[model samples]
Target: MSERRPTLRERQRSETRRVIQAHAVRLFTDRGYDAVTVADVAKAADVSAMTVFRHFPTKEDLVLIDQPARLIAERVAASPATHPLVRRVGGALVDAATALTGRDGDEPAANERFLLDCLRLMVSTPALRARHLDSQYALQQAIVDALGDDTADPDTAFRAQAATGACLAAMHTALTRWAEDNGQTELPELIARALAASFGDDVVATGRRD
Candidate 1:
């Protein structure tokens, strides 16, 4: 089936959200995340406070709004079922990381600095850390759902959550290292190394066990 295009209203809302995000990044970077209010972001974006809230419900969201986890979940859900489950899920996260690093144009070179700043802010903020944990839980559930298994059983749910946690850990380690390097290394390269460190050289390999 052909893909349905976004409506004009949808496009407008997306653009507005982007504008608000950009403005929020600038303000947060200049004044610090804790100091910047939602109203401040709205003022910078030339939008109402209500509009800012509509796009990003909380102050922390201005930095944490990117949906890499959700995108990874979608990729896992859409992966070929013939592959081994580990390979499919890990490959989906790798794909999502690549897309997030701008392989698919979701990120741009200009935004890398902004992203780094936001990452630093999240690292230092307690509330943002809690929100991040909440996001991670949602992402974990998403991965379990994508696996197409009956995860109602405690053991089944635990395994699914464990695998998802590992994937997220790899991505987090890579991102933290990349930020520490001040954008000198390509994000995808670091991501690959981190995943390999966790799962060995054939991180996403679907080969039979020896």
Candidate 2:
């Protein structure tokens, strides 16, 4: 007989990972990142320390997670080549915002709060801050890879870096402003305005040039 696939068990395990990560974030945010040991997190989540380590190798990963980076990469990869990288990235951001907005029945408020918590942790914790820089560097590499080697010459690389950096800066700035504004306006609108300010009318024009 053929070996049975473990799809159901795998999904249960995946859900467990998410649960552990969620509890870890809650503990880390409520206490301090440095103050919360893996053992403490495991106990809080009702899992063993080994189980926590299985899900997140490092304490920092507990806060950083993987969904956002993976989603951004997938979006970039799936975008059309006819569009400029800037427009493609912008469109990806819009898609991400829509996903977060719960138009597809996902919980936007909860996800927003999770992002806010992540931003807070990344800014406030030294270890997490370093991890954030590493993540951005990885993102830069991914952008270059997506653009392809033929298009990743020095000039193209520079432009890609600048474009990605501008978008990230705009995102951080918008999120900060939104936090200060008590989230009066939705994140998507803030993100759109920020991107427009960064790219101006030049997005299409720049992309069309030889």
- Maximum-lDDT candidate: 1
The residue ranges of model 2 lying beyond 4 angstroms of the native Cα positions read 1-6, 101-108, 149-155, 201-210
- lDDT (0 to 1) per candidate: 0.76, 0.73
Off by over 4 Å in 1: 103-108, 150-154, 205-210
- Candidate 1: clashing pairs of residues: none
Task: State TM-scores per candidate.
Answer: 0.86, 0.81
Worst 10 residues of 2 by lDDT: 201-210
Which tens-of-lDDT digit does each residue in 126-183 have in candidate 1? 8887887787778878888877764668897787778778877887888788778876
Model 1: lowest-lDDT 10 consecutive positions:
201-210
- TM-score of predicted model 2? 0.81
Q: What clash pairs does model 2 have? A: none
Model 2 score (lDDT): 0.73
